[model samples]
Target chain A: MIIAIPVEQKDPDACVSSTFGRSGYFLLFDSQTNDFHFLESTFATGQSAGIRAAQLMIDNHVGVLITNRCGENAMRLLSAGNIQVYQTIAGSARDNLERCLAGTLSRL
Target chain B: MKIAVLSGKGGTGKTFVSVNLAYIQDHAAYVDCDVEVPNGHLFLPMDRASFEPVDVMIPSVQTDRCNGCRACVDFCAFHALGYAGGQVIVFDNLCHNCGGCRLLCPQKAIIEHPYNIGSIRTGNFEHVHVVSGSLNPGQMQGSAIIRRMIAQTRPFPNQILDCSPGNSCHVVQGILEADMCILVTEPTVFGANDMRICIELLKLYNKPFGIVINKSLDTRNYIKTFCREQHIKVLAEIPLQPELAVLNANGQLAAKQPEYRRIFQKMLKNAHSLVAPQNL
Candidate 1:
């Protein structure tokens, strides 16, 4: 599974989100089996950015999502598409990605 | 006179007013609470000494203490934690440090630990002391650092807070503690919309405020008329002067412009009059 993930460094497998804007991942993942992407949600999913983000996630067919955190509206949008959101995990991008693959992130 | 300068949108003269006001006052401490993009230092360069690091609480999981009950995740309002299987993966960056995770942890494995998000820097520009805090990039929590900088204040007679542009937590924390807030804006459409939001926030907090039209348009402004209709006092206005922008971009204080200095001096007088009790 070529799973997409959010990483500090923006690489082919990782989409790094910058604190400032559109940089946070609207990542593409080949595998749905493991890992999640971090998503910072706007308060309302109706926002242009948020709407496009939700659409992009669905379009890309990402299986799992790992984000630093998520708000209510964003969670609802992602959930509507059957995407599971795991809450804040703050480590270097690679370390957390490995945990997701192992399915070792459930016991918070 | 503790004054806070704010705008609901970014790039609209919040820092301009702050840096110039500090230069004109030459005695007050200038606090830059916009940790996101603290550009005030560029405007008012000084010999700054770094202040203490700003720390935020992040939840740590102790496997031995956790009993595998997913209560913490179920109770999290922010969805900051979860446990679907027998594994503990902490999203430290996602955590808002709200304590729900620790409180709801069935196994008592969750513990809060301090994490450094950013730091503070203090300096002197002429005689005016300047302090600024910036959030580390990729950290969404900007307000915490802004709050930390304000908490460092000593009850002073006069201080100037050059707030971040926006009604986000960073701006609120910077403005909420102020005796008065100064809304800075231009005469454009973006200015009008953002000013309305920011003005509403000030009203929500019941913080007394007036308006300062920075980079004012040379032709005319319906904004001044709009404010008058809404009963907002106009503290000052600075026209779109190319020289001022150039100097400002070059790391020069706008107040150094003979004209700009005169304008702030006049506004300072008006600021006092607006906030001071009438000697009736």
Candidate 2:
């Protein structure tokens, strides 16, 4: 399954962005292959950025989303896509991914 | 002629000036374009009011014929559409009712639906016709409602458009149909500063406008100084009186009182000369 984490930077060690919609970059991690890549967020400063960000995750076939917080509209869209949202602890993108894989992170 | 009363800052008495101006005129229409929080009805209570719901077109997708095209989703500039779980979801609030999605839909799956954003209330207060727009709570289509109200009140020769605070798109809609504008402002540094933006907007639109200093404490104040420097005409000044405040707080029309009646009458006459100097 592919997990998406809104990150501050493209690097795996970048801190998870506090905001899901206006995040600068999204780190897409493939849990099965232990591989990952970064995708730049398009609607970071646009209107309804949350909805656009959620749509980006849906288009990329993201099965899980890990972030600090999610807006109501974006949450509804994410839920409609059947993507499980997990709450992330304060740490780097890779650390949150590791915790998510270990089943230690809680569902948001 | 339609005169829009506007102030860039809130609580500068846009409604106060508008209500009085409308009240003083014979066969005038009071248009409350501040739809988000319309309060002109408080002073000029409507009698036998008729309401009409304002609706905007929102697109709905028929998933069966959508074909997973993603055309509508990508076409929306407002990002009001989202595709997930092989289905498209429409965020009604974010949609500006542009109808581009419905037009661009290749599969004929997208259809426009009427969504009620607000209502327009029209009634009579003695000789003055009152038309106020009330936007539904959490709705962001004040501009659309203002436009509709302006169109409806076209037959009335004299109009006082009470604009919402600031130079937002909402204010732009309010001033669009107006022949002249009356900028009501308070005598303060902040009030004078904010009024500059509204002046700039009027200049950009090339609309003739004058200023009315509300809540004035003295002859020499911030608003007066700024207006002099800009060479803008000061139409009238409403004194900062405790009795006026009390009467206004109780939803009483200041123009109804004998003393304040002359003030509004003169203000209206000055505002008339702004657009029609020949009549002066």
Best by lDDT: 2
lDDT of 2 by residue, B103-150 (tens): 888899999889999999999988899999998997776788898889
Tell me how many clashing residue pairs each candidate has.
20, 0
Task: Estimate, for each residue in B160-201, the C-alpha lDDT of model 1 and write its tens digit.
Answer: 898878787778886777878889888889998999999888
Most TM-score-accurate candidate: 2
Report clash pairs, candidate 2: none
DockQ of each: 0.06, 0.88
Candidate 1 residue runs with Cα over 4 Å from true position? A1-108, B276-280
lDDT, candidate 2, at A10:
91
lDDT for model 1, please: 0.70
| Regions of model 2 farther than 4 Å from truth | A9-11, B276-280
lDDT, residue B273, model 2: 80
